[model samples]
Target: MPAEAGISGGSCPDFIFPPAETPASDGMTHPRNPLAAPVPLFYTCPMLTTLAIRDVVLIEALDLEFGPGLGTLTGETGAGKSILLDSLGLALGTRADSGLVRTGAAQAMVSAGFDLPADHPAFALLAENGFDADPGEALVIRRVVKADGGSRAFVNDQPASAATLRELGGMLVEIHGQHDDRGLINPRGHRALLDAFGRLDVAGVAAAHAAWRTAEDALEAARTDIENAARDREWLDHAVEELNRFGPEPGEEATLAAERADMQKGAKLADDLVAVGAHLDGSDGGLAALRQAARRLDRIAPEHPLLADALAALDRAVIEASEAEDKLAAAAEAMRFDPARLETVETRLFELRALARKHRVDPDALADLRDELAARLDRIEAGDAGLARLEAAARDARAAYLTLAEALSEARRAAAVRLDAAVATELAPLKLDAARFRTVVETLPESGWSPAGRDRVEFEIATNPGAPFAPLMKIASGGELSRFILALKVALAEQGSATTMIFDEIDRGVGGAVASAIGERLKRLASGAQLLVVTHSPQVAARGASHWLIAKSHDGLVTRTGVRPLGADERQEEIARMLSGAEITAEARAQAMRLLEAA
Candidate 1:
């Protein structure tokens, strides 16, 4: 065996020996002959390669290496086997107890290492929790518990929460005890297990459910809008009618104001034109007097040169005066105002300004407001038809969801029947022949519907023929419960199973043929994965590819628990010890040899 606690290439080591040429249905390699070929360092399955502990209960400092296949640990009643399991649980983020620390120790620490396949679920979980893990790399989880009961956790040497460790541990290993609440024993996981066994796809049902929710939401929103519009129906109709009658146009306010200003200016200039018309009215006016003086000057202009200059000036003045009079007459004609037209323009401008104020908008935006009000009124009028369409769509979506859910429920029922039969076949071998196993698939009410469909799945068992079926946890005997769990595990095989499994004294109450049967099934299970069995049964220990003897030794001052890895001869001696009470006899050795050979 390698000194380090991890995977390495070598010949079939004492830790892992498979029987001659057996094909595994779970898609893991089983060596054709243990002595002939070298065992590769990497296996398709994930493996718990190492567990290191310090100052935890009776264990002081311990480092143990592991490998693939069934590895058995055996010890006396007070040999600290429970301590080993507790240490592993601490590393796996179980509750931290200060009492677990050793005497005079400040803290207890445990670290667990695993070699995983590229596609293991733990890698994805690490990523989800903000840790980076690569394919083909070993994962390490460490936990430290202070004597005061505080704890800290690390994943791959990076700081993490205990919750994260717990989640990752769930994916890496499953520890099955008589009263275990996790894995197959938990009712919550039974549905997923059934689906995995049947390879059922739930994506279609989930999509249908989501579609139904979206359609219902849309229908509800449309109904709310219609109800709100109905509340304002009278106001909208009145507003639309008022706007339509007024017929406000873009820029109409500015246009009306400009026209009114021009009319008022013309009216003011009418008085001024009348005053100017009086100055050029007749012969006594300025234009007639200038014409008379110009005629007189024209007659005297030929008598003297001075007289001619005067006549030219007088003629120029008369011509300019006549042009001014003509312009004044035209101004009077253009400035002519009618009171009726001014009054009409003023009234229209007032109405436009009043409408703009009532609507709280500029005149230019009044036209857009009119259109919006009209649209609201139209929607209120068509509210019943729109609601009908939306209701139909919602109904269709609900129908589709029901159809898919019904199909899924049917498939689950069929899968449940097959699973029950499979579990039945395994029960007899585990010495539970008289017990009955059942997979219950019950339909839930509509209120209980979900993306997983409207069905509830649970695993129930009856220990006796006429007994009522009850949950596994409620079984009267721990040994029977453990046996039932083993049977179920064997039947399910690799379906929804963790890569590594630990059975804590699963063979506690049985021996001889039954113990051998449990050992055989465990070995078969280990063919595709890793298993660590804590056993008192010599038969089960004899079947181990590797054996560990957990012993508690005391020096003068302190007692400590340690694990010793056994070679082939050492394993045989341990099995002999287990067979014979306190002393090893010749017959026990021979029997141990027979068991080993049979394995």
Candidate 2:
């Protein structure tokens, strides 16, 4: 026991389990072997691994720890604990509330510390960031929120995002409260509770959920695919028909466009050539008259130089007309009209424009339509096969999911029986004898994927005989829920309790023996987990391994709240005050002392 009490050989020697952190010999139940006499199992203090708060709503300076067994926090109603939790929640990946920033603060910082047990999953998270955390070393985190409205988080002083913090936080904590944003309030939380109680080992559960979700998503996508196919089936068929009719070659448009332009101007060019030829011919055209003039001039020019000049001018005119005729012929030959080619051009242009109007696309994009329309039609026609495949796949997936879910439900059912009994046993001392605790596992195959299961897992209760059994969530008053939660925690102790469990005056309505019972259960739970309770009940506080006093102080205008653990003598007096209201009576002090000794 002495050796077990010390830190493992890897950690610093002075950094031992805190003395007050150990379990007390209050003869608690042996969760492993309940039939045997109750045994007081020894436990070492849990390491303080990490803490952080940043510019998060109302947080000024955030400092805390990865604490162990029952580290209780106490303050007045609005002493900022809730805000602290909100900041932690946000840092862990809840939605970032820019409004959380203090009015005068610029940005908020949140951070956490983790002590990896050489194999904690958080180590992998750290490794992803390239930080090689030492084995057995505490993973320290710090976050600073700037007064100017910006924030930063660090793991071992290395930068990280709020998302990473959130991912890691999920594995680190499971906060339970009837009305909290966490826990059973969200239906999505149901799957997690089942998983936790089912004893699933990490990757297995995650993988199963991944596969299930993928299958579910595929089915949904297939439904949409089918709907869309039906919607466009008619349009797709029409488009494919039109595209096939045109049968336009891929590059036909460019070739036809060039040919059409040349043809449109061909007649004008030919007309010019004909006019020049006629003129060049005798009397009928320019060339013929020029030739006739040249002949007359030539006959006279045998002696006159002026006649020679007139013949040269007529020759120049004839040459010009001959050149124009050749130019027009060349133009006509380049156009080279084929009736079939012209008809093809007109047909293609008309088809392209008609398709363009039909599909609301540019003529140039007709080729694109041909491919698109054919593909769409093919898909619509093939949709029967696709939908069949999807539905088949969905059925298979749902079956697989149901198989596991049913198996889990069986485990839960068996566990629920024990759970109910265990809770009932705890309630015995709490004075709820006639009150029955029941776990009702309702499997609703019709209800779509809830985080919990196909089954609506609700805790049920019959507080009084003949009273209709109703869901624990709805039927139990706040006090009953607290007690129910406590009893559930007691049953789950062996599975491992949260590092810290805080019950704010959970012992409020009960007194005398019931207070003692609550204290006893807390003590029993504290054996494996830490229990922090804020209480006015002396019985409850008497069972605390350590006591803290939350008080207010004023230094000038600054009002500050502080917590300090009470000494043994101080504990005696405080318990007396709690027992006797405002005054500390000798009898009350004596009773407190006896309670302390009895504890």
Candidate 3:
């Protein structure tokens, strides 16, 4: 609901089809400014020539030339039109028909020459497939079928595969049939159709979807981090508390405790042992006897210094004995221990050691690791702000998408109005006055849109309004489907384009004015692009600016189909025969003239 950029607020880039100056297709919506139309082709290609073939289906040594305008192929049932189409398809790299080679020929060959502009899209394809070119020469593609059913392709003499041939072939031509409805009917292809239809809003929806993904990813990461960090907060707090209380400094308490414990256990025994040692040394009682002897020695040796030295030695010995007695008293006084303090130190050390064992780490690492865990917990607590930012981004993205989608919806509605009116006009002459055809414009939720917008526009019909609306493809019978396709092709003209459009028996089950209407539509379609139609009606056949008659022939053992470009008199004769059935009556000839004149 937020304010989004306005529709066409210089946002959607305008599409301008360039070769410039094809009129704004009258079939589609006409804005004040229209895109340029590409230049039309001037048929110069050597694409399949009815001119030459070898052992291919019912076609052999057949020669045919097509024009830039609509070309119709007409023949009696089973007379070989399908075979010609098959051969063309083969040269284009379609699957092989090993059994289709002429009755006795070793292989089949389908060759086509194309005359295209120097910058033609098809030319690029030919070159990409490794075909050589002579600057102005038209492209040549050929497929050869071996006797054993194997097939090979060549582009301008360079060996190529059937796949490469098919790819290039598809670009150059499109063959359509009632059952081959791939482009307009498939929902998977709808997005591209809308894009070509100039619906720019779908792009906005895609942008929004992308923004949503990115924002969602960021939000998820933040949530995970918060959960992990928060989960450890209680444990981290406990660890820091334990470390703080212990106050384990470097080795001081451990040294004091060790010394005290050793002294307490040994002090009493040591005191009694020291008293015994003093008695043995005669330090406490025979001191006077030793002193009197030392003095007599000093008198007798008055003339000898050795006697005097001996008296000094005795005095030194007495001083050392007194010093030893003082040391023993000190040792005895220092042996007392305090149980309360000892128990405290031992418990703290045990706690550190036990924690280390439980955690599989060294005791020294506990404090540093505690700080890291605490930091992680704090980070988790901070993720809420990031999640808020993501929510905001997703909102903005959706808003942007909706804004664009609305504008695209409006454009589609406008196109729908014009399209319905035009198709109705086309269908009226085809004997469907009661048929109500419409371009259904429904506004769907944003999820339905691509980059173009949230509008699902389906070409629908109420064979009668009381009946439920059904898509054109779903309800129309074969003949009706053909008519409907013509109406749409006429309504769209060439700007609403496809790479190829094929019509198989679109002319079946209709004649007179209805057939004429079909012909006009085909002509209109051709003006916009290429159209290949198969017809049994002379009216449809006569309308083609170019003509190919599919005929079957027997030469000895082979029954084959052949195609040829009809000369003017021959075209008239063919149309006459169509009007008069199996016989070419004069009346039918006159009618053919009138039809060609009106066309």
Candidate 4:
């Protein structure tokens, strides 16, 4: 199917919403979820309240106040209408340069004030970014452009960057033109517009995408680990087995060396133990002699009291000798050594040292190295299982993402149905009744999937019957494109955040009834927000709720451009002038009167 030619009627076939299944009609009944809470009215829409421009291009000094409802700016071809828009653009954070300043002026200044509802999001954003804005009053944005092309920006009297000004401006106003860089024409904003229309929870889809990516990352990491570990698997296994066989224990080397030293010392002490043992228990030793003398004295002790006392002293000395001998015997027994056990311990200690040297580690650290190697081997053994688990998680995550994306796609299709019907209704009024607008949502290939979703969305159009539909940017003429943009703005107005909508000569080529239809639509579009149109059509000018006249004048020595709000009579005269060139006639005034009345 061609881009926009995929659908025939306003009904979207892929839409799964309740009321969206019905065919397109002039009027649509959007389905409300029963579980959804009733919407509470918060802030009234914001509008452009004041604009001041000085030394800007042809505009020397200009101040304009805007109220609610549809307003029109009427001027001759080169009467500085573009200056007004450019000044507003400057205030809205457009690039500032010397070209914008008047030829003789040193600098230029553009300031815009907006009357926004107290609950407007811009205030919160300002607070978040540390910009002071009094929510109770109007929001002000000011820009200064110097002759040297330097620029400065301020919001609510607080110094700010151009980006801040641009953000605030985006929420405050939307300017639509044939070649505007902002607004609904930009393809980047199409998805958001559709989601807003559908009232879909796009954040949910984003979260799902994030989850999917996380899972993908986890799986990839696991696979990479496996690949890396495979290269070292053989060495790791051999090292682990060797360490296990040696069975190195903490402090084993030091303990074994201390035992070996003790055994060597005991061997040297064995001779000394033998000599001491012989003296203690020898037959002719002092203890044996003492024992014999004590027995003789014991036998004669009854005959003499002195002899008895001497015998008792000898007996005490002999007892002391026997105790000494017993201690020597025990000491000798303790000195006994096992040579085979000592040799085994020495061999084991040497092996441990050799293994430590092989691994380039201290003997004390061998145990830790062994444990680390074991852990690595275990991980390699578990690699296949871990990879399988990660793969399962990735699959689950992808499923979750697909589910959310499919649901979001269904919601967008439903929204497209209502949007198409709404825009379709706007076509005849804008003199593009033969044209068709479509929100094309095509599923992308898996490789092309991103965080945004698995779909590509574009706004497409067909200008004439039987013509192949193409991208809106490629197919529509400049005038037709502007009208289409206007229709889309009207269709999405309720969902739009901007409080002010400006059209820079959207009514460029059309006249007669087509211009009248554009005026009527503009009036309808201005019901809740503010609308400002730069137009040459008398019919459109006559329908203005408020009118401003832009004209260039010569003040003797200088040329200047001035704009002022016109009264009822002035408005009538301006409209008459638009209808009858330089000469305003009675017939033209009558027609202007009729047009104003009809409007």
TM-scores for candidates 1 onward, in order: 0.69, 0.52, 0.59, 0.66
Runs of candidate 3 exceeding 4 Å displacement: 1-53, 91-97, 111-171, 190-382, 440-449, 455-457, 462-467
State the lDDT of candidate 3 residue by residue for 377-455, as single tens digits: 6666556676687778767766776666675666666555555665676767877776777776677764564544566
Candidates in descending TM-score order = 1, 4, 3, 2
Give lDDT for model 2: 0.61
By the lDDT metric, which is better: model 1 or model 3? 1
Candidate number achieving the greatest lDDT relative to the actual structure:
1
Poorly placed runs, candidate 4 (over 4 Å): 1-44, 118-130, 134-137, 158-164, 221-382, 450-452, 465-467
Error of 3 at 318 (Å): 91
* Candidate 1, residue 112: how far the Cα is off, in Å: 0.8
Write the residue-wise lDDT of candidate 2 on 1-599 in tens digits: 12232233231222222111222223332121212122222223333355556455555555654344554444445555556556556555666656777656667766655544565556776788677667577766555556554556666667777677666665555444434434433344443443343343334334565677787798786667557756977876776787788775666667767777676556446666556556555457666666777887778886877778877877887787778767766766876566677777777777767767877977677778788767656656777787688778777876776666666666666545545555666677776777887667667764554434455666667888999877656655666667766766665442322244556566758899998998887776666554567676788888887777655566795544444677899888888887887678999999999999988
Cα lDDT over the full model 3? 0.64
Better of 2 and 3 by lDDT: 3
CA lDDT scores, all candidates in order? 0.81, 0.61, 0.64, 0.80
Candidate 3 RMSD computed on C-alpha atoms after optimal superposition onto the true structure: 20.2
In candidate 1, where is summed lDDT lowest over 10 consecutive residues? 1-10
Better of 2 and 3 by TM-score: 3
The prediction achieving the highest TM-score against the true structure is 1
Local accuracy of candidate 1 as per-residue lDDT tens digits, 1-599: 01221122232122322123222334443332222232332235678999999999889999999998999999898999999998998889888898999988999999999988787778878888789787768899999999987998999899998888888888888898766788888898898777665556677888999999889998887777668768988787788899999999998988878777766777888877776777776867877788888888888789999999898888888888788888877755554577898799889889988988999999889899999878666767778897788889899999999998998887788666656766775777788999998889999998988888888999999999899999877888878888888777766555566858899999988888899999988877676668899999998998888999999999988999999899888888889999997999999999999999999
Clashes of 4: 0
